[model samples]
Target: MTSRFPTRTSGPSSIASSIRRPAALGAAWAALSTFALSEPSFAQNAQPPVTELPEVTVTTTTTAKKKKAAKAAAPVAASQQAATPAASAPSAGAPAPGSRSGSLSVPTTAEATAEINRTPGAVEVVPGSAYQTSTPATTIKDALDYVPGVFVQPKWGDDSRLSIRGSGLSRNFHLRGVQLFMDGIPINTADGYGDFQEIDPTAYRYIEVFKGGNALRFGANSLGGAINFVMPTGYDSDLFGARIDVGSFGFRKAAVSSGGVSGAVDYFATVTAQETDGFRDHSDGESIRGSMNVGYRLSENVETRFYLNANNVDQRIPGSVTKSVALNSPETAAAGNLLNDYQRNIDTLRIANKTAIRIAPGTLVEVGAFNVDRHLMHPIFQWLDYRYDDYGAFARLSDESRIGGFANRLIAGVNLHNGNTDVRQYVNVRGQKGAQTVDAEDTSRNFSAYFENHFFVTPDVAVVAGTQFLHATRKREVEFGATPGETEFNLWSPKVGVLWDVTRNSQVFANVSRSAEVPSFGESVNVGPTVIPFYDIKAQRATTYEIGTRGANANFTWDLTAYRSEIKNELMCFYSAFGNCNVSNADRTVHQGLELGGGAAIAKGIIANGANPDTLWLHASYTFNDFFFDNDKDFGDNELPGAPRHYLRAELLYKHPSGVYFGPNIEWVPEAYYVDSANTLDTEAYAIWGAKIGFDNGGPITAYIEGRNLSDEAYIASASILDRANANSTLFEPGNGRAIYGGVQVKW
Candidate 1:
């Protein structure tokens, strides 16, 4: 099949008018699948968002000669990569280069950690080596369980309630505040809405969590920050690997991956498939995902990479139940869900390329573009079909040098993302389309330019400053029922901070930043009972003050941060008529919290009179949340719903030199917060226990056994939002019951 770019039309149109199609984003996808069967890597992306990537560089005349030279050296690079298995570590001086990302080669764990330490705010890097092979990391929740200040509650399947610093806490369903990325490319739609169903938690080398406005590097300007799920390259991954997992609730999963260098091209590919009957009725789901990346070296300082991704997801939503039903009969599905056979199904494909060039010493430039095509078939009270065509381009320049005899690091980037959606709605006849109800077209355009700089004031301290400019527009053309709606937003956010190097491995940092969120088409403007183009609704804005310290020494490592957000025109979801919701702006609110995480080795040598020395490790994460309205008209000083006031996750493990380990973990919520703006009702707090035993030798073979919620405690997992909730409100989602899972992996 041939892929074509979209052409601009003069006037508004309906869904039946015309639509675009894309394919051939598949041939390479097949290559990835085939490679996975022979050998595998864990860098997975949501069913590759079907996309077409346009080259973003100047073609050099020496391409032919460069290719030939690269081919000659490929064998040496491949052999060196093959020598290191999955569990090897890179040195701090010379980087163990993998594939190219941005204007530099992909770095190993140690290098990645060193790079992220430059951020003068709350940020962290979670290495895949820590969980990818040994844990059931099938979703984002599993990958981020240890990150402080971020809250992730699994709902069902790959869906979850995820938040950073109370972002999108009251606006339920699908991600709103956080920007999700795979290998530095955006997975969110043009309008900044996010979904995690396509993410394969097992397919990543590392995940970066940038809390609040620290995400300026990625052109992300939001209250919740950004998460970058980075896949490994040929040099960073095992030559080949495979794994399988099975557990209670009729759950099963299998994955395979491979990476190698042949000639000038180095590649990494992975595939995964899984299904489960689910712990609650009407919650069955299944998915298959694939990802691949190919790289070529035009020269030592200039290179380009190609990426392919695809996913197919089908999920049955159990729907929220009343609080009593959630705790008493947790397995029961809502009657309305069963009656309508509610479900969310999607198919996606994405193809893209990035080029990095070293223009001069200490100066690098990167440019890339991509296209995404996705289809969404959803059935609830009504049948909704949406076809998405999204494309974007990005460019960045980074330089490190001295100015006035002072060290300086400078970075700047710009991004443009635009898309159109073909929408058709029909009366639902139990999961099937009935008579057509409406046809429409939705278009979104977003553009952003950002820059951040660090200027060293002294040998041990630095000053940081940055700013971002954003422009967004939303247009909806309705063929029937409602009138057309078109709106636009523009914002400028600035940041300033200071960083003090307390030690070679530790730092103290603080920052003051501003952020803004423009509403998505999903949250259209409504006035009284009439739907219109717009009312007085405006973009959500916040000013945050943050301070923190993070570092490690000897056997102790810690990360702690505190922050407060004073918000204006906060966007919130309120109860609309007929079990629906609408977005509105609130007067004022305050959000303040503390995030703390630490790990230490308290003892050593417990086996056979210290004959075989071992270490006892304990890791803990704690969060304190205080979110409330600031003397509003309808709700006065009421706590905002959606999270617990106090949450903790802790684990204790015994480690040996041979990589064999065992650990017990706990998830605790001390008290429940309100579930509604009026504070009429709240959820119940509870604790769950789990354990893990694994042999992560990173040799020819490895295995693990895991158990979750072993006590089978009944509790609420997540809840919906409303203005004034009551006892009979169907807003609670029950937590999963006791379950056990085990998996074995082989690497070569």
Candidate 2:
């Protein structure tokens, strides 16, 4: 893979960055640890001992009270276990029987547990806590601010490019390789590409990132893996609330939500609106989103839920900045930039449902399905006009149960999805633009079904196996630019793995899986006379292997993973000349890296000797990645571009039981290879630190202030070579010099 933008052909040189001290972080951790460890020994005690059930009557969501059967009428076997407190007693301040839990406060679901255990590959789940109090970013991409291993570059406020373990290369349009899902519904269009604008970060309950084979549960089409954004469920408890915020650079946002029970039913609804005047010229956008879920109880043994989500976004493109422009005026636009001269708008809608049934003792079955539709209108360089429409549907089924004797548990599931898409291109002669005329139209369909099962081979071990079958069909009205737009083929993907429980709180696992990615619209489109003619491109395939460990013990929790992937048909890009470049499938490539992450608590601030506050919190992650081509003829002995070699992020949080808090954070990137293939601009490594302080009234009203880039270091986020500069380049986007913003919130 090469730089997404055109850059000098010289090699890139990297200077190792120096390590710095975070004394504040160390102090915060020590404090938190001390507080947590010294807390009343009773707090660490397992669930309280239980005796016979009380005669108390539990009110159902429907306002219907069911009589508690006499102990003598209890079911035979598990009844004895019910008399004891659950291994994981509810946390302190837990919601009442059927009330909704706070957004980031909900407990993990069954699917989440399956992912935690059955994964034969590396995976990480960042709870909502990471986003609720941090950055003001509006998209899911923003939530990844300090996440390690993953690299997300926001083009503007609403659009971003994401790469994990170096999978989605040569992609300038939609996201490839990585599959995205929300509430079990596919977020990618019918053509298998995802856009960041479709996601509303504020609406999600939690995000799960499954890398390599661990994603087998979703399917093989996701060569880089899958990311699922879960939403609040009816079983959760909450009330209606709204938040409104305004900040620097014409940024504004508002969101509202309602969750509660009303008669044998639980429902949740959320709506949000946001707008921004981008840091660069012509970089402005506005968007609105809404999501809702309702649950119904049919009987003692059955429950069902319905979900709806939608988004509308409008924005102007602030094309890539030239190296010079990027460094000189990072927040300014180029004089006659074609890329940033266009306008684009997107609209999308989604609907889905899930049902769970308790078929027998310790056995349950679940089914889920959803549909998504999206439309995009894009203007190019103020000269070219384009339009696209996509629609897709997905369905899944699975069963969870514990078998006899062996003390074994099993989880098996299958998924089916299909999509259809249409695209058109036109030229706006002279100024007036409105999709002048249809230049191209194509429709594609993908049908796939996958199943995987987890078998507990022993009390301390488990094995997992799964496979996917995908058949695709494409029909194009015209073909001229790149590859044959019309095609058909069937592919099979398989995976297997094992996990060993090191202890009750920790486990280790490893697995190998196969994945494939088909071509995107731009990859097959024939554009003009100077551009190369189209040719059929095969699906990119890869074999990945990963191993990791995760554990949690009252005071400390950590997760780590190491992985490597060898790719065949890695699509790479090359610059030929002015306004000319080519995208060709490579023979082979490799990606390997390690991700270390964990968090710890140390001190007790205002809370009584470790009461209910996370007095001090610490979280950190480090990732090292290396990607290169394997004996390629065209591009020789050159490292893949874009990502830095080593990335590190750490945070130190301090809080007062009264709700006032302060946090200091840092992000470091080791100078690696530059964007260009030639080692020309040997980039230097750098580190940036930030601090945030806030006060909470304890009962709803809260205010906070933050300052980023406190170091005020000169750094570049993105750069590109100018067509007129020959070998010279300019920075397109400059990391903010220093920024300060603040906001307040109120809840009832």
Q: What is the C-alpha lDDT of each candidate?
A: 0.74, 0.59
Cα lDDT of model 1 by residue, 420-499, tens digit = 99888888777678888879988999999999987877755779999999998888888985456788888998999997
Deviating ranges (above 4 Å) for candidate 1 = 1-105, 525-536, 608-612
**Superposed model 2: Cα runs more than 4 Å off:** 1-115, 337-340, 361-363, 382-393, 401-404, 407-413, 429-431, 434-437, 479-484, 524-535, 575-581, 602-614, 678-684, 696-699, 718-732
* Candidate 2 Cα deviation (angstroms), residue 360: 3.2
- Reference-based TM-score, model 2: 0.81
TM per candidate comes to 0.86, 0.81
User: 597 in model 2: Cα distance from truth in Å?
Assistant: 1.1
Instruction: For model 1, give the 10-residue run with minimal summed lDDT.
Output: 12-21
